[model samples]
Target: MTTALLAIDVGGSTSRATLVDHAGNCLGQGRNRGGNPGSNPPDLANAAIVAAVEAAIADAALPGLTIELALLAMAGPKFKAVQDQLETALKALGLTGPVVFTGDLQAMVASVTAATNGYCIVCGTGAGAVRLRDNELDAVIDAAGWLLGDAGSGYWLGHQAARAVTADLEGRGEKTALTSAILGDMGIELNDDRLPDGRPVPYRHFVDTIYAMRPIELARFAPMVIANRTDPVAARLLAQAEDYLVQDFSMVFDRELAGPVVLGGGIVAHLSGLQSRISEIMRGAGQVPDIRLVQDGSVGAVVLALRSAKVTVDEAMVQSVITSIAAHGLRARA
Candidate 1:
């Protein structure tokens, strides 16, 4: 008969759902593959979301408990469509309550610093930063799609590596270990004008290739672009990425609010050095701000839901939530 709140974080590559009581103790949790309704086809994305939520509810084994509220954090630009799809999925699950749907960035911002007033820089499959001041969204920058933007993201990094290899082969750029590494990893010959057998290499192929490699492997090639930051041939590519983020934070400061900057997303979490470099560069421009990284955004979503619902966030409550989430054993399972 315990009423529980559900928090869901849907990223570009995966989704997670956690159930917690009024005390912030997580009761059960579930996870599945990515379900970005804005990016994926409507029907397919909705099905995936429903499946993940149902699996989590079942995993919790709280058969008869009623869900009091469901807070969803989903990635993508189309918030209304995502909300409608989520509501339909919830109805299909035979459970309903006060469901709140918001951007994945919002949950991410709340997660890192646990602050209602701050900014969040998310670098994952894509890259972007958002700021909230006094609980109101203030600024957002560089959230453009893969083709035009998303600097410092896995997709961007991988795409750049591939381009560099091609440039070197064409005698347009300096040779680097990334050329051979990319070829060996993808099992493709570097000299081939097109992908093996005259077919173009799929863009996603490069994305997966870079993501599948170890973090050290990717970082090895990422810094090469830093040296070329000013050359039109390479100058603005990497440095501009960092600059874009710095600009995003500057916008927040221009608003004259006192808040730290929270950095989240897989890319930022794994590449602390890159984030530090970006921060250092930003410091030289004046208005040096605090930066914190959030590895797991779901934890923040849970915290936000608890706070918004008027629940106290004490150290003991935080520990209880961690224990409950760990007891479910789903973090690694996903």
Candidate 2:
């Protein structure tokens, strides 16, 4: 019997679905809007999940494919109400197999490293870190959401950038390039009497331009700040962001733990400066272990699925799956 694997990672602003064969070969990948019920409406979240799953199935074009394992890695609190509703939605999409729902930490721990015990940090649209012990989520440190946490997340940085630009515009803070960069990014002009589109201006008329954007969209300016990091204001912002990340990393990391410290999420994984700074800090704390950046998390979910299926998870096998799934996901996005 040919068994298939279904992996879904649901975040605050986006959800991705990937289907793979028992052999760890990529089948199809689908992406949809935010599906976290805690962030979006319950109905909207459920619809996003079904849409992504169905799209992935259609893309695979594998008729009669029966998924043996399905996992949903979700953000926010795993309320029972949300889980029941999500499971109902999955069942409606024809997934009736053994389904599991994991918190954001469990998913990242599995995806970022092969180690059964270690630490994994995610700093994407939101931020948080989780400690893995014996391959289970042991302790989580403050990567929750923007309302109460997520100090180093994209949403947080974007929000900070907005505040900086606004302060400068209002003459309450020093001027910086971020004002023009943010205005340009939003298609608004700084110091303009009014919005060209008649929409409220960013700072002068209102913060409507920034307010109109989703958290993920605002995070796009993170790179802009990076580009202008030479400016004192931008450099200060980056410094603050890095400090928050280091503190978060320190919080979940047990110095004596025996596992690699894996880094995921856009801010930490892709940014070399941030990665180096975080590494230096870790070394100072004597918590250094293998530090690796994960390519794609959907591939990690497949590894866990393979484990549940009683397949051998070794170095070579894990590498092969990662490579294949990474390529497949790239093709999917392209």
Candidate 3:
């Protein structure tokens, strides 16, 4: 019977599971909601992880195969606390071998390069930077949380967008296109009531709507902010985001590290404008950055899983896994 490897990437926004064999063939993949224990309730995160793993097992349809090992690359700081629960759930699903958990940053860096020393920058619902020495995390910056740091993150952008609109509505800030755009996006209309400042606004409606949601949910406006970059307010927000992200990368950057600098997560990977700006900044600093993008941590999990099994994973093996994942339609956001 062919042995299988289970690899999972759990993030602040989504969780993914991929089942692959030693030959680098992706047998099946599954996805579920965010499963970050630090950012989400432990029960909810555990549930999401189990759901994704179960779905992947179901998708494989090869019940006879034994899962030899499982590796989960997890976002958030508190995943270790739930490791026992996760292992129990995986065993119930037929994971036969030992389970390993590691920081998501390792997977992010491994997804793009096998080199031992490198830098990683993640910008999704949150933002952070890390330096990897010998394939282990050596330094970190930001990644605090929506309420704390996470500067240049998706939540940060959305929060800035909301603040800009609120300021404009109250007549305390410069007027910009974000006011109408945000209101329309939220399906909020201008109310007849005027604020004490005499500006016609939907203060009550907007405030009530925003207050009703968890602060992290503000990340929903990130894409809108990115989309409305033509607006002066949005443009300024993006500029600030870019600056913050660049700052994160710079803080952990080592001029002597010879390995590639890997960037993951939705914001930095998908936003060409931000990517270009960051590249420009790095170049201006007289550093020739070997930047690479891994859309999510899934591929990195696969690489780590293979390595853990003593499989000699070269670039050829990694590329084969990448191709198989794409063929199986498991590539997350490409």
Candidate whose lDDT is highest: 3
Cα lDDT of model 1 overall? Answer: 0.64
Which one wins by lDDT: 2 or 3? 3
Report the C-alpha displacement of residue 73, candidate 2, in angstroms.
1.5
* Model 3 weakest lDDT span, ten residues long: 269-278
Q: Write the per-residue lDDT of candidate 3 for residues 189-293, one digit (tens) a residue.
A: 965788677666696678889999767778888888877888888888877877787888778876666567788888875455656765665676676758888
Write the residue-wise lDDT of candidate 1 on 117-211 in tens digits: 77777776667778787766777777664555666765566567667766665556766666556566567554444555554353335545656
**lDDT at position 149, candidate 2:** 83
Question: In candidate 2, which residue ranges exceed 4 Å CA deviation?
Answer: 1-3, 192-206, 213-217, 270-288, 309-312, 329-334
Q: Write the per-residue lDDT of candidate 2 for residues 1-334, one digit (tens) a residue.
A: 3347888888877788888877778888888987877666778888898788888888888867767777888766666776787677666656658777777666666675567888787887778888888878888888667667888777777778888888887668898998888888777766545456643355744376666665555677787777888878888877787778778777877767757777777677545466676567567767664777775666676777777777877767678788887788678778
Q: Which candidate number would show the highest TM-score if scored against the true structure?
A: 3
CA RMSD, predictions in order: 5.9, 3.4, 3.0
How many residue pairs clash per model?
4, 2, 0
Look at candidate 1 and give me any clashing residue pairs.
Answer: 111-300, 229-235, 230-235, 231-235
- Runs in model 3 lying further than 4 Å from the true structure: 79-81, 194-201, 269-287, 330-334
